[model samples]
Each structure stands twice: as C-alpha cells, then as structure tokens.
Target: MSGWTAHLPVLPVVLPLIAGAAIVLIDDGKRPLRALLAVLATLAQLGVALWLAGIAGGLLHSPWGSEIGVYAAGNWAAPFGIVLVVDRLSALLLVLTAALGLMTLLYSLARWDRAGVNFLPLFQFLLMGLNGAFLTGDLFNLFVFFEVLLAASYGLLLHGSGAARVRAGLHYIAVNLVASLLFLLGAALIYGVTGTLNLADIARKLPALTGADRSLFDIGAVLLGIVFLVKAAAWPLNFWLTPAYSSAAAPVAGVFALMTKVGVYALLRMGTLFEPGGRPPLFGGDWLFYGGLATIATGAAGMLAAQQLGRLAGHAVIVSSGTLLAAIGLLGNQYTPSMLLYLCSSVLATGAFFMLIEMVERNRSYGADLLAVSFEAFGLADPDDPTGPDDVVGIAIPAAMAFLGLSFVMCALLITGLPPLSGFVAKFGLIAAALEGAAGLTPVGSWVLIAALLLSGLAGLIALTRNGIRVFWSNARSTPRLQVAEAGPVAALLLLCVALAALAGPAMDYLQGTAATLHAPERYINAVLQAEGVGR
Candidate 1:
C-alpha cells in the first residue's frame, strides 16, 4: 500500500481527538461555531470510516498484499509499540459510530447542545474514545479508551439540570468507576502473567504457559469478563442502564445506544481471540450464555412494566445486548452474520426511538389543548344536525402527529422483529441457523434462544402498542409544530433501516464474509505480528 493509504486505520481516532481539543480551546460564546466545527469533524470521520470499510471489502484494494490494515505508531513494530488494526469488524463498527455521531450532533444543534458547558467538546471526545476503543489492538489501550468515553458520558448524562438526571448520573458514575477498577486489576494481572498487553502477542503466548500461571491468567480473564458483562448490562449488572439512559437528554440517550455495544464488541473480540485453537478454550462462554438469557428476561419484564417511553427504549437496549451476548456464547459462527444484522437494526431503531420520544410527548400535550378547544366549539353547535362540527373531529389529525405516529410504528416494528423489515430478516436468519445446529449448539440452548427471541418480541409488541395508543389514540387538544431539525433525523434513521431491508442480500453477503474472517483469526494475527512499519 501507499504510505498514505496505510495510515487510514489511525485517522478515525486521531481526527476526533484533534477536533475535541480544538473545541475545548474555543470560547463558549461561539456556540454556533463550535457546533459547525463538531459537524465538520464528524463528517470527516464518517468519510474515513467508509473508506476503511471499502478497504476491508477489497473495494479499495491496495498494493500491500493484505486484507487487514495495520498501523504501528511512531514507526514502532508489533509486540513493542502501539498498533491500530482495522479489519471488517472494526471497520464496520467505526462506520456505525461515525454515522450515529453525525446524526446525533445534527439533532443536538436544535437546542440540546446549549444544555451544558463544553457540550460540543464532550461529544467530540466521546467519539474519539469510541473510535479509539474500536481500533485499538491491545487490552491496555482499550481500558484507557474505555475511561475516556465513560468520563465524557458522565458529563453528558447530567447535561440538563434536574433531580432525576443528577441522581441517575451519580449512580451511573459509581457503577462505571467500579467496572473500570475491575478492568485495571484484570489488565494488570494479565500483563504481569503474559508480559505483553497486545492482543495478538497475548494469543501467541497463551499456549506456552503451565500450571499456576495458566490458572492466574484464567482468573484475570474471568475478572475481565465480569467487567465486560457489567458494561454490556447483562442481568443483575444492568439495573443502572435504564435509569441513566432514560433520564439523559434525548440526543445524549440516542448516542448512548452504542455505548453498551462497545462492551459487546470487546467481548466478541476477546472471546474469539482466546478460542480453543489460539489460547485456552473460550472462558466464560457458559456464563455469557446463561447471563444473556437472564438479561433478555430482565429486559422483557422491564419493557412490560415501564410507564414511560424513554425507559422502554432503555429496556430495548438491554434486550439487544442480551441477544448478541447469547449468540456469541453459543459459539456458533453460523449465527454471527445474522447477529451483526440484528445489531445494526437494533442500534438504529433504538436511537431513532429515543429522539422520537420527546417529539411524541410534545405533540400529545399540544393535541390535548386542541381537543379542549374543539370540544368547547362543538358544545355550541346545533344538536339536531347529523353532520355538524362533530364530523370534522374524525379527520382532524395534525400533520406532525401523523409523521410522529408513522415513525413510532416503524420503530416498533423494527424493534420487535416484525415483517417486511431488516429486523425480521435478521431474527429469522439467526433462528434458522440455531435450529439447524449449524455450529454445534445443543438442542436445549437452541430452544432457550428461540423462546427468548419470540417472547421478547411479544413483550415489545405489547409495550409499544400500549404506548402508541396512549400517545395517539387517547386525547389531544392541539397539533404540535415539529421542526425539520427534530423530525428530519428521525426520518433519516428510519429510512436507513428501510434501506437495510432493501439491501439485505448484499449486506448479509458482506456480514457472512466478516463472520468467516473472524472465525479464522490467523490472518488477523499474522497481519499484526508481521507488520514492519507504516508503509511496508
């Protein structure tokens, strides 16, 4: 590859880092300028991500004679210096993060950015952390990037001043602090035992260790798994997710949908890296299997019991996380391609739903006012006339409510895995693969997953149906005036989901290739360990 092409792996992380630093130096009075800068930076990041994905897909093949792009910082080689590796998986996630960042920032430009100091900077920093985490090839830097994003999230969670936001933010902060400590302890133990923090190096070294040393590594690995589980919001460890996410500002909550996925991403990377052929046989697979089932159950129960739309969305995030975790735990390569599709569908649907919640609530209040006025006017109409003012009430729904309702229904269908959408395609593919025992999944485990998938969809259907009725069918007085800034992003997100459905054939083909590559990690290991320098 050309020198410049080889450097694509690091740009996703570096661009946002520079922009965040620049935003921090700007005065708060120039809020408009800050927003503009954030938009430009995120757009550029998106471009880079798309380009890297092209490289991974062989659509932008280089002279380097390799599929993966590996970058070593400061001309340092692997096992001795920092490395950033971009394959199909990391490239895919980078694209997702950048797309979400751009859309969320656009929505925030309406008014959410003014809710707190340094909002623009924090947003950029969060993107930087997320990109860094996805691209980093070592456990130590993963912990560092994890902290970077979590710190920014703490500020964003409490962006608006309110008792609920503050209370939830505090709890969120406490839980993450403990998780970070566990991450550190676990990292230190692994580094001490293996004498390396690089993932490829660790995998290379695993089979050589004996007796007590191997046991020590296992303990550290389990501890690290717990840290990831907590972040993934698996069952008992997930109590804080719904409250914190539900109470945060809409834009913040929209972007936060990807945060839990970060945990899932980490687990996937590490779990596959340590599979039987490379290191110890996959540790914690059973826990992930059972924990995921419990997480699905918890999310379904929470969704059914939730009184507010935001909390319901929060539960939906938990359900998505559990679904992926369980699929991974089953150790079925056949399931990964389908799971990837479901992951994309869930993230987009949940993010759009979070944004839609505020608009729906606003319209409901406005509709209430309009209804009162209509009732007063009807009371003065002639009682004997069959087609008097009452006739107008039947068809008087506002355009904004119509838009919001349509968007809400689409979101509901996407989340619940119903027909004619990407959601159904994904869930069906997964179920088919599981039932066929394509990857050695036991009958009991397959049945459990089937039950979770079907029951969770039912729970979501009931919850969203009730909320839709209350928000639209109940009572409203006036039509809510929706702005392009508010409604446009929601439309764009839903349209993307539609597009995914339309392009299901190509998307599945790509994901299937990605799954195949992931299951065979030797190429990844070679790419990292054999790199000479940036342009070699």
Candidate 2:
C-alpha cells in the first residue's frame, strides 16, 4: 500500500470528530446549516469506510498475505506512541457504523429539536467514539474510545429527562460505569502482565505467557469479557435495558443500535487474539454459549411481556444480542466471518425498524397505556386520544389486529433466526459450524441452541403481533397525521433493509473472507508491524 493509503485508518474516525466540533460552534437556530454539516460528515465517513472495506477485501485475499494498516502520528513508532490499525474486521465495522450513523442522522433531521444544544454535538461525539473504537489497534486506546462513546451516550440517553427517561437513564449509567471500571481494571492487569498496550504486540506476546501468570491472564480475560457482556446486554446483566431503551426518544435510540454491538465487536476482536486455538476450554468454551442461550431465553420472554412498540423494539435488541454472542460462543473459523456479517446486517435492520416505530408513534401520539388497551382489543387505537394515557381502541376485533401484526411477526422471525432474511442465514451458518465442531457433546448442545432459538423466535413473534394488532390495525378511531417529511427517514431506512436482503450473497462472501482473516491474524499483525519496519 502507498503512504496515502497508510493514512486511511485515521480519516474515517477524524472526519466525524472535526465535523462534530464544528457543529458545536455553529448557531443553534441554523437548522439547515446543522443538517448540512451533519450530512456532509456522515457522507465522508461512509466514503472512507467503503474505500477501506474494498482495500481490505483485496489485501486479505491476496496470495502474498495481508498486514494491518498502521498510521504513525508525526512519524512516531508504534510502541513508543499511538497507532491505528485497519484490517478486514475493523474496516467492516467502520463501514457498518457509518451506515447506521448516516441512517440515524437522517432520522433525526426533523425529529430532534433544532435549537437543542445537546443533540448534534452529542451525536457527533458518539460517532467519534464509535469510529475510534473500530480503528484503534491499542488496548488503552480502545478504552479511551469506549469512554468517549459512553460519555456521549450518557448525554444522549438522557436528553429529555422525562420522568421515565430519568429513571431509565439512572440504571443505564450505573451499569455502564461499572462496566467501564471493569474495562480499566482488565486493561491495567493485561498491561501489568505484558508490559505493552499495543494489541498486535500483545497478541504476539500472549502465547508466551504460561503458569500462574497465565491464570492471571485468564482472570483478566474473564473480566474483560464481563465488561463487554454488560455492554452487549447479555443475560443476567441486561435488566437495565428495557426501561432505558424504551423511554428514550425514537431517533436517539435509533442511533444506539450501534452502541450495543460495540461490545460484541470487542469480544470478537479480543477472542481472536486470545482464543484463536478456536475454543479454549477456559473462558472461550461452553460458558459464553450457555450465558448467551440464557440471554436469548430472557429476551424472548421479555418480548412477550412488552405491550408497546418502543418497548418491543428494545426487547428485540436483546434478542439480537443473544444471537450475536451465541454465534460467537459457538465458533469456528467459518462462522466468525458470518457472525461479523450478520452483526452488520442486523444493526442496519434493527436501527431502521427502530426509527420507523418512533416516527409512527409520534405521528399517532400513542402512549404505553393506549398500547396496552390496543393489545388487549387486538385493534388500532384512535390517534386523537385527548385523554393522553387513558385512550382506548375503538372496536377492531382480533382478526384486524392479526393483519397488521405481520410486521412484528417478521421482525421477531428475523431476529430469532428464521430464513430468507439475513438473520436466518447468519444463525444457520453459526449453528452448522457448531454442529461440525460438536464431536462429543456438541450434538446435544447444538440441539439446545436450535430449540432456544426457535422458542425465542416464537415468543417474540407473539409479543410483537399482539402489540402491532392493537396499534396499527385496531378499530381505534385515532386521527391520522403523518407528513411525508416525517416519514422520509424511516422510508429510507426500510429501503436499506430491502437492500440487505437483496445483497445477501455478496455480503456473506465478504463475511467469509473476514472470518478467515480474523482466524489467522498473521496479516493483521504483520500489517501494523511491517508498517513500522519492525520485521522488514
């Protein structure tokens, strides 16, 4: 690669940071100006990500081998200074972040209060953090990126501070703070053991540590896993998600689609470095799989309990969380690429769907109580309910509700691992890989995965259908009032969903390549070191 391309890793993350800072200084009354700036930054990030993704495909597939892209600041060497590495996985995740960021920005264009100070800057900072997380090749840098993103999310999540939102935000902050501390402790322990913070260097060095220190390393790995698991909202630790996500403004939550997946990405990246022997019996083995299955079961049950669109969407996210972690937990080299691809596709679908639900709710002035009534009646409630929370659906029977309930059913099925959609393709690939690896006990384990997946899918579908019936198809006489401009973002998002389904074949191929590259990270390590002339 040329020196010009060597700098590619930093541009995707930096563009957003600069743009976001610029937005902060701009006049708040300038709505058109803010939108223009946001759109430009988003587009630039998207362009960089696409270029990097293309470059990664060529590099990884090259017979000569691949190396991580390392950009030295002011010509500084890696260990003595900061470095960013872009490989197939990082590049792909950057692209996914850009896609989701752009979609959410579009959704927020008209949805956010133009005069609000926190809206634009906070989101820009959030993207900066996300881009940083994906590109940085250093462990400490990854933590910095995590904090940057989490801090921005802290502000974004509590933007309105409505009573319910405040309640939710408290829980969100508490869990994340604990997670952040764990991340720091893990990093500190790893740094203490290895004496270096560069991930590539650590990967090369980790294999050399055996004995009590190895056990210490194992503890650090488990701690790091705990931090990410919390972030990913896995089972037993995901209790805070429902109220927090459901109460946030729709567009805000839409942006958050990228947030949860960061944990999954971290786990995948770290897993590659530590558990490359495939599934080590310790931290990488059956524990993660069982925990993931438990998460799936809990999320499915929650989906059944949720009565509103926003809440249902929140629960759906948890279900996706289970699928992602479980896919990773049931790993093989072949499945890794598919899992990465599936996450990218799932984030798009879930984010788009989330934006749509928010728009529909705002247009209809629907509330939680109205949602409950509609669910019970199996019909759409009136949009003009002046009584606020007490509004009831007029008279649609269960049959009418069943018709509009199709969307929820599709969503449930999509997240729970049914076919035709990308979710099924992803889950199928993961399960097949697991079965292939299950020599002694894997058959029973694989069967358990399949059963949990099916049961969760059914439960989510039932819950989603129940809510959709009450909201969209109910005999409720709510006045209709959605302007085209209001729905434009969601319409654009839905188009992305179709695009994913249509482009599934090529996407899966890319994922396969990415997985192969991740499994044998020689290219990733060599790229960064070779850039530094350490091995050359």
Q: Tell me the spans in candidate 1 whose CA falls farther than 4 Å from its real position.
A: 277-284, 363-398
TM-score of candidate 2 versus the correct structure, residues matched by position: 0.87
Off by over 4 Å in 2: 1-3, 59-67, 276-283, 363-413, 434-441, 477-479, 533-536
Listed in order, each prediction's TM-score against the native is 0.92, 0.87
**Model 2 misses residue 507 by how many Å?**
1.0
Candidate 1 similarity to native, TM-score: 0.92
lDDT of 1 by residue, 258-309 (tens): 9999999988888777774333332336777788888999999999999999
lDDT of 1 at 57: 80
